[model samples]
Target: HATHCPKPFYSSMKTQLVSAIHLQEVELDDIEGGNDPADDKKDPTYTVEEAVETIGFGRFHVLLFVIMGSANIVEAMEIMLLAVVSPEIRCEWRLEDWQVALVSTMVFLGFMLCGALSGYVADRYGRWKVVVAGFFWSAYFSFLTSYAPSYGWFIFLRSLVGCGVAGVSQGFVLKTEFIPARHRAYLLPLATIFWMLGSMLIIVLGMTVVPTYGWRWMIRLSVTPSVVLLFLFWFIPESARYNVSAGNTRAAMETLEWIARMNHATMPPGRLVESAQTERGSWRILLSPAFRRTSLLLWYTWFVASFSYYGSVLSSSELLEKNLLCITDADAEHRVKHRHEEGSVCYCIPFAFSDYQTLLISCLGEVALVPLNICLLNVVGRKLSLALLQFLSAIFFLLVNICTTMLGFTVLLFLLRALVSMNFNVVYIYTAEVYPTVARSLGMGFCTSFSRIGGMIAPFIAQVLMSRSVMYAMCPFAVASIVCALGNFLLPIETKGRALLVRLCPR
Candidate 1:
C-alpha cells in the first residue's frame, strides 16, 4: 500500500482476490461432486416403480387405458357373439343342440390352441408387436365371419377370431406395467366396464338389427371397432418394464424418457434395475416348484370362473324358456294366424330379440358392481373379496334350482351374474399382481388357457343339463363356485396393497 499509491495497483489487487474466490468455489464443487460427469453416468438408485410413480398418471396413461380398454370391447363382442347369434344360427342352419353348443366350443378351441403361444411371444418379443398383430388378425376374421355360408365355415371363422382376441391378455399385462401401483386397484377394474359396454352394444344391436337385417349384419357391424383399434394401437409404446426385463436398457431408457417428457417430469440420472437373471420365458417356469402351488390354484380358479361366467351367459336361451312372458305356440299362431298365406310370416319364438333383452338385464349387475367393487375390494382385500363373491354367487346359483316362478328365476339370474362379474374382476386383477415381471405374461397365459378349457366344455354342460331340469343345468356351475370360494380362501398371496415382484425365482 505504501508503494501503491497508484490507482492501477488497487485495481489489479481486487481482480486477484475475485479470481481466488472463484477457484475456491471450483475446488468445493469437485469435493461435493455435484457437477462431476461420473455422477451422471452412474446407474439410477431408484426402481422402475418409483420412477413411474414420480412421472404420475396423465394423458400418457389415459391413452394407454382407453386403447387397451377398446381392445377389451372387441374381445367382449367376439366372445359374446356365440351366445348372441346361437339361436339365429341354429334356426338358419337347422342345428342340433350339440351343434349349437359346438359353435361356442370351437371359438375357445381356437383360443386354447394359441393363447399360451401368444403369451410367450409377448414375453419374449415384447407386448406391443403381438397386440397389433392380434388387432389385425381379429379385424380381418371378424369381418370374414359375416359372410360364412355354413355352420362349419361359421365355426372356423369364430375360432380364428378367438386366436385374434387372445392378444388382449397380453395387452392387459402391458397396461398393468405402465400404471403406478397406487392406482392399479381402482383403474384396472374400471377398464372392465368397457366389457359391460361392449356387451350392451351387442344386445342393443341384437334388439334392433338381428330382428331385421339378421345375425350376419350384426356380426359385420362388430368389425368396425377392431379396424379403428389398429390405427390407435400404432401410437402405443412397449412397456418399459418389459424392455428392462428383457435387458434392452437403452430401449427402456428411451421409453421412460418419453414417458417423463409427456408427464412433465424429470428422469433421474442413471440406469433402471430389473432382475439380473435373464432366462427367457418358458411355460415350465410357471410350473416350477416355487410357483407350482400358485399355478395349480390359479388354473383351477380360472376354470371355475370361466365355467360359471360363460355357463350363465350361454344358458340364457334355457333361462328365457322359463320367462313368464315367453312366446307361446298359440300366441305365435295368433300373431301370424291372419297372414298364413304370406310366405314371410314367421312362427319362431322371438329368441334373438328376447335373448337381447335378457342380456340387457344381465348387464345391470355389472353396472351396479362398478361402484360396489371399488368399495368391496378396498375394504376386504382381493383374496377375501373373491372368496366372498364366489360364496355369494354359489348361493344365487343354487337358488335357481328352487325357483319356480320367472320372477324368482330372474332375480337369481341377476344376483348370480353380479357376483360372477365381481369375482371375474378380482381374479383378473389378482393374477396380474402375483407373478413376477420375468414371467408375468406367461403365467397369465397359462392360467387363462385353463379358462378356455372351461369355456370349451361349458357349452356341452349347458346343452345337456338345460334340456333336463333347472337344477341339473345349474349344479355344475354352483359346484364350481363353491370350489372357487374355497380356493380363494386358501391362496396365500394377497395381491392387494402389494408391490409387483421383479423376480419369483427361489432364493
Candidate 2:
C-alpha cells in the first residue's frame, strides 16, 4: 500500500529548519508567529536564551547585579584610566601627547592579540577559572603600575595589563551567561556602571589627588577595588552554561537545579544540552564564511570604538586645555601639587606641562551617557545604537577642524562623546547576546582580543592625527563605523528569547 521515499522526512526537516530561521532573526519578526512559547519548551534540552530567562529573577539576583556592576566599573577603570590621566601622565614623563597615549592603547592592542588565546583557555578549562585568574592577575598589575621604572617599562607593563583585560571578557561571559534573558539589556548596562564608576574614580582622583600626589598614586588606586573584590568573588558559581557546553550533563543539570532553587522555581524536569560537541572551537571554525563576516565586523567595530573611546578620553582638549591655562599660574598649580602630595609617597614632577584636554568633557560625557545608552540599546537595536554613535563621533571630530567656536566645538565635542560612551556598554551586551552558550565566552574573548588592535591603534592614531591632522587616520574609524552598520544586516541573529538549543541555521 505505502511505498514511500524518505524525501518527506528530509523535506519536513528542511521546512522546519527554514521556519526556525525566520523565528530567530534578531532584527525583525524576532519572536516569530507567537509560537506557543511553553509548548515548544522542553526540560533538558532548554536553549541558552531560555536558561538566561531564569537568571535575574532568582535569589541572588541583587548580588549578581552588584557584582556584575562593580566588575564593569573595575574593568572600565582599567581600560580608560590611562586615557583619563593622559595629560597629567604626559607632563610627568615629558612625553609627547601621543607617546603617553600609547601606554593605554597598547594594552588594548595586547588585549586584541590575546582574545583567541583567552577563549581557547576558557574552553579548555572553565569560565570561572579564567574569570578568577583574570581578576587576581589584574589586581597585582595595578600595584605594579605604581612603580613603573621608565616610559619603556610603563608601555611593557601596560601590555601586560592588557593580558588581564582579555581575562575580564571571559569573566563577563560567565557573569553575563548566568543572567536572566529578559533582564539582560538592563542588567548588563547596569553592571557596566563600572566604566563610568571607573571614570568617576579617576575623575575624583584627578580633581583631588593626582595633581598633588602623582600619577603613580592614581594608578595604585585603580586596582584597589578589584583587590578587595578578590575576596568578594568567593560565592559566585561556575557557569552552568559552560558546564553544559563541556558535555557534563550531570554537572550541568546540577547547576541549573541549584539556580532553580536560588530562583525559588521548581527543579526543572529535563536535560540541558549545553553544546553538541562539534569542533566548534578552533581557528579553523572561526575562518568559515559565517564567522569571517562577523569577525570582520567585530574587528572593525572593536577598533573604531576603541579609537573613538580612547581618542576622546586621551587626546581631547578638555583637560589639557585647562592645564595649559593653569601653567601660567605656577604657584596655584604648585600649591595644588603640594596639597595633593601632602604626606604622599612619591614626588615625580613634571618639568613643564603640555597642552591637553581636561576630562571635563569626558565627565560631561559620563554624566549623560548611561540613560541615553539605555534608551538606544533597549529601543533601538545594538547595531544601530553603536553605528549611529560612531558615525556621529567621527563627524564631530572632523567638524572640530572646520568650526572654530569654543562654544560650538565644545558642544560638538560633548555631543561626540555622548555618542562614544555608548560603545563599550552596548558592545559587551551585544556581543554576549549574539553568541550561543557553547562558544559564548570564547567568542567574546576572541572578539575583545581583536579589539585590542583598535585599542593599540587608538593611541597611535590619536597621536598622529593630533600631530598631523590628516583626515585619513581618524576618518577610517568613521568609515569603519559605517561598514559595521551595514554588516549587521548580514550577520544579525538574536538569541534574546530563544532556547539554548533552538533550531536555527548559521547562514
Candidate 3:
C-alpha cells in the first residue's frame, strides 16, 4: 500500500492506521476493566424460580397477600356459615338430625366433586380466570341460598356454592407461585389469620344479625366479601410461573416487569428461560413413582386435618349446649326433653349471644398459634412441624373427654382448634411447596378434594353423634389426628428453604 506513494494515498493510509490503533486501545481498556461490548448487546436470562427469588419480597407481595388473604376470608366465611346456619335451618324446616347433617354433607360433596376439575381448568386456562369465575359463581349461589324456600333448595344452592369455593384455592396457588421461598414459610401460615377473622366474623354476624333479622339477612351480608372480591379481581395478575409452563414467554416477561415496577426493583436484564412444557394438570405426574408416596400421604393428612377441624367447629354449639345445661341445672330436664324430641337440637335460636362469644373466643386460637407455626415451619420444617401439630391435636382431643367444667372444656377446645388450624396451615404450605408449578393447583385440588371427603363425613359425627355422646364423637377425631401424625412422619419430602419447582425433571 505504501508503494502507491501518492500524497493523498499516504494521508488516507495514515488516517486508517491511526483509527485502528485508537479502536484497539479502547478495546484493551474495556478488556482490562472486564467490560465486554458483546455482553452489553446480549440480554441476561433466568428461570421463573430465579426471577421470583431475585424479585424477593416487596410491596407487590404485600398487596397480593391482602387480596389473596381476603379470598381466604370469603371462603372461610362461606364454609363457617354452614355451621352457624345449620341449627336454624333445621329448626325452621322441621328437619331431622341426619337431614341437618345432610346440608353440610351436600356442600362438601360438591366441593369434593369440583376441586380437581377446577384445578385442571386453572392449570390449562389461567389461575386468574378460574378464581374470578369461582368468586362470581359462589356469590351468585350464596345470594340464591338466602331466598331458598325449602330445605331441598337450600342444600342444592349451598352445594353449588361449595363448588365455587373449590376453585378459590387456585388463588392460593397463584399466591404461592409469586411468593419467594423464604417468605412463604411465614406468610402462608399468616393467611390463617384471615380465615380466623372470617370464622369470627360469621359468628359475630350470627350473634347480631341472625338473632334480629334472621339467617336470611346473615346470608345476604356474608356474600359481601365475595362481591367486593369480584371488583378487585382485576388487580391480580396471572401467575408468571404458569405463563412459562404454558409456553407464554412474552406474557411471563411482562408480568415480571410489572412486578418489578410495583416492587420498585429491576428486572434481570435477560429474557425468561421458558420452562419445558408439562402435561398441564396431569394426575399421572402426581402418582408417578417419584411423587406417589408423598401424594398419598398428603391426601390423608389433608383428610384428617379437615375432619378434625370441621368436627370441632360443627360440634361447638352442641358442646356449649351441654355445658350450659350442666351450668343451669334448672332447665336441664326441659332442654333434655326438647333435644330428645327434636333429635339433637343444639339451639332453639341458631346461636345464643353467649354461645357466639364462646365460639369467637375459640376462633382466637387460630390467630394465636400462627407465630408458633411459623417458627416451626422455619426451624423443624414442614414435615416435622406438621407431625408435631397433629400429635398435639390428638392429645387435645383426648383431653376434651376429661373436661368437667365449661372453663376446662373451653380451654381444651381452644387448644384443639389451634392445633388443627396449624395442622391445616402446614398442610397448605407443604402441599403448595411440594408440587411443581405445572401441577400445583391440580395437586392442591386433589388434596383438597380428599379433605372434603372428611368434611362430608364430619357433620354426621359433629352434628348427630356429638349431640348424643361427646366421647363418641371426639374419639374419631383423636384417632384420625393420630393417624395423620404418623402419616406426616412418613412424608418423603421436606420443602423448607427449597425453591419451588417450575417443572419436574424428565426421567
Most lDDT-accurate candidate = 3
For every candidate, C-alpha RMSD to the true structure in Å = 7.9, 12.6, 5.5
The TM-score leader among the candidates is 3
Per-model CA lDDT versus the true structure: 0.78, 0.64, 0.85
Q: What is the clash count for each candidate, in the order shown? A: 1, 29, 1
Candidates sorted by lDDT, descending order?
A: 3, 1, 2
User: Tens digit of lDDT per residue, candidate 2, span 203-299?
Assistant: 6666666768877888887788888777877767777766656666677676767777777776434445545454445554455554566666766
lDDT of 1 by residue, 78-178 (tens): 88777777767766886666887888888888887778888888889888998899889987998899999888899999899888877766788989998
lDDT of 3 by residue, 452-473 (tens): 9999999999878876787788
Between candidates 1 and 3, the one scoring higher on lDDT is: 3
lDDT of 1 at 132: 90
Q: Give every collision pair in model 3.
A: 44-270
What are the models' TM-scores?
0.86, 0.77, 0.89
Q: State the number of backbone clashes in model 1.
A: 1
Considering only N, C-alpha and C atoms within 3 Å, which residue pairs clash in candidate 1? 44-271
Error of 3 at 436 (Å): 0.7
